[model samples]
Target: MNAFAPTRTSWRPRSLRWQVMAAVIAINLCAALAALVVIIANARRATEIEMLSSLAIGARFVQETVERIADEQGGTASLAQLPLHINGLRHVRIRIEDAQGNGIDLAPASHDEADGDADEVPDWFTALITVPPAERDIPVVENGRRIGEVRVAGEASDEIAEVWEDMTSLAVLALIVNIAILAALYLVLGRLLRPLKTLSQGLQELEEGRFDHRLPPPAFRELALLAERFNALGAALRLARDDNRRLNERLVQVQDDERRQIASELHDELGPCLFGLRANLESLERMTAYAPVASAAERVATMVDILDRIQGLNRRLLRRIRPMSLGHVPFAAVIADLVADFEAHSAGRRFDFVSEGLAEHYGDSIEITVFRCVQETVTNALRHGGARHISIELRHDAASGMLKMAVSDDGSGMRANALPGLGLIGIEERIGALGGRWHIGSTDPKGTRIDILIPLPPANVQAESAERTVIQ
Candidate 1:
């Protein structure tokens, strides 16, 4: 199975979405914490106030009842009667003091105590009397002189503790849930944006000389449209490139056509005139064979040599104008002809041709392309390869319909940075036109090789036979 299987939401960036959601949840959690703080603070204050109020009411009832009992007893209450009036109240703790010190009730008396020993009210009781309630104060007066006091205490309650605990637990749970939600969101967002990053990378690749890489469409509608546009632009650029290539080929073809016409005109007109002039000059030489100065014969001989040289130049020019026919010729025989021609033209080099399973006859264009490619290879080997020997090989496979041609030389081959020659360019163009592939490289130690392989054209046995008849 292919990795990155196509899907609708494949473009999502998983990590980024998690980050965004975490941020959102973090904000909510901060707000929640702040609100929880306020609620707890206020609740604590309310609980304290309620407890203090309840304590104050109990204190007030005790104090008023004690004052009423003291008045009914004419401002004197016996120690034994104290318990009767203070009975049934949760607040009452009695301490009766004489002029000297203090004495207490059911609770055990402190050590170092004397009866009626009233130095002053105790410090703890005094402090409780000094501090005021949040809303109001409770006053206890006897004979308009403050001797002792009762005050509210114990503000925290079990019910309020339970409520606060539950609130705390819920806040913590909310925090955990928020973190999970944010993590999920971040993952989703990261997945969404991943394809866009890949697309940007693809564009950079295209810019860096890799025209084949293509950007894919995004999952979402908006990004998908953008992807489609980019793909369309790439397609357009490829078409333009193809068009430019075709136009260049047409230009080369036109130039070749013009050269052919000029060479034909030269051959038809200038060549015959030069030949006729040479014949006339020869006849004149015969006529003046006995009645001529010494310089006349020498001049006639020089003219003949010059004419012969010109004729050779004309033949070379015509050969360049139009390539020689190798279509009807046996493939091996044509290779032999090319080698013989090259050997005759250049010294200090020998040529070799090899044929294995070559076709009886190929189309003119195929033969021409192969021949030109070989010719170019040999020319480069002599002119640039500094070669002592050149080798050409032609092979074909009937089953596979493949033709392979290679030219190698024993020479100082091309350097790494050497620019391709016009001939090499021509070979490449021709192979490209025929949808074939060609490569040039160092063959071995001190040598270059050019290799070409292409699918063979369908054989035309009848056409080959007719051409063989004509030739014969």
Candidate 2:
């Protein structure tokens, strides 16, 4: 399995702003729920207390009314009006009953429309807030004769209805306030986090190798410090990249200088020495040819043959060390000669060289890099890839100021898991130093293809003027 693949637990909001907003909303909802629960519990307790208190007061009032009525002359008859006296009492009911079983019941007046809709409070809510029924009995007597009793019972439907209305109003108000808070928070957070988005964009630029990208200071102190650090990092990366490019270019120049020195030494010193040795051997063979000794003549001829082989080997080494004709010949012509040499040595192998829009020369570094890259690629194709057919395409686009080259060979493709060898890595360094790009890939059916694009310097003013003059 891929190590970088995200697992189920790795899931998360893709944006910081949304993540923060979600967290805020969750916290607000939880707090609202907690507050609601507290309000409901407190309302239930307050309603229960109010109902019991009202019933106790009503019972005391009824007891006093009964004793007053019984002391009067028409006390038994006046007991019928006790219900009317207690009719206006809140959260309680009263009833007066005599020995004959006749009674008048009193209840608080219905004000469903004036108070609020009773249906607004559900049955479950009413049941949850309901208090135990409170009741009290007051005896009625006239001249010490038993008569009737007054009963007071607690009632809480009206009280519960009032509490439910207050709760709903508070709930609606809280909802509106929370929505307003969330909206303002969202806007403020977006404004606060906008700098982070800019920082994100700057990081992406860095990833794409645009090291010169910089971030501006944000308003927040923490973000401003972070931006300062980001700018410093970009500056450091840009300086490092420039230094590396210069170092690679210097290294390439040094390598070329060394190769040129070695080639010069071989040509000036070894070439003449090999010639002298061959001359001496040929002269020795001539002197021994006239002798009567056949073994001496055979030895001289073998030595002469060995000397020829040595001279040939030395020439090959010189060619490998440095291309002598590079500066003296056109770049395209030099490449063509290289292909010709390869074909001559490798039997039954084909080499094709194509060129278009190429000038007579580019700078020393550009020329040398291209030559070395081509040389390395071809050698690898023959030695490792076992390629029998190779093709090179060189093109120079003056308008775009780029020199493009593609080298392809029909051979076994590179292995999927194979790492780049030293030669390929060197090519990369060389190309990167020139601010160019190169790609190597396996060809269709078979073989490997390498493509290189190097930016070309602008043409000389004098050369361009002269060409225009000639054209005019």
> Which candidate should be chosen as best, given lDDT against the real structure?
2
lDDT of the candidates, in the order given: 0.64, 0.78
Question: Could you give candidate 2's per-residue lDDT for residues 1-472 as a string of tens digits?
Answer: 5665564235363577777777888998898889878977897789789988988898888777776665665655366666655556767766778868677565435333423555667998888778778788877776677677778788778788888888889889988998898899889989888998899999999999999898988889999999999999999999999978976886788688768977886777667767767776776767676856666666566667757666666666767777788879877778787778788779988888887777777868888899889988998999999999998888776667788899999999799899877678779888988999999999988999999999987771112211110000
Best-performing candidate as measured by TM-score: 2
Q: Write the per-residue lDDT of candidate 1 for residues 1-472, one digit (tens) a residue.
A: 3465553245354445555675687789688979766766666566566556656665666567667766887764344454455444322233444333344343334211322122233443223223233322233344555444333243233325444556658878987887787677667667777877887887887677465667777778987887787778777777877877876886688688768877876787567767766776776667686756665666677667767767766665555554454655676677666677778778767777777766567777788887778777888888887898888877775667767888898889888898876678778878998889988888756798888987776663223322111110
Model 2 spans with C-alpha error above 4 angstroms = 1-11, 74-77, 100-103, 107-117, 290-472
The lDDT of model 2 is: 0.78
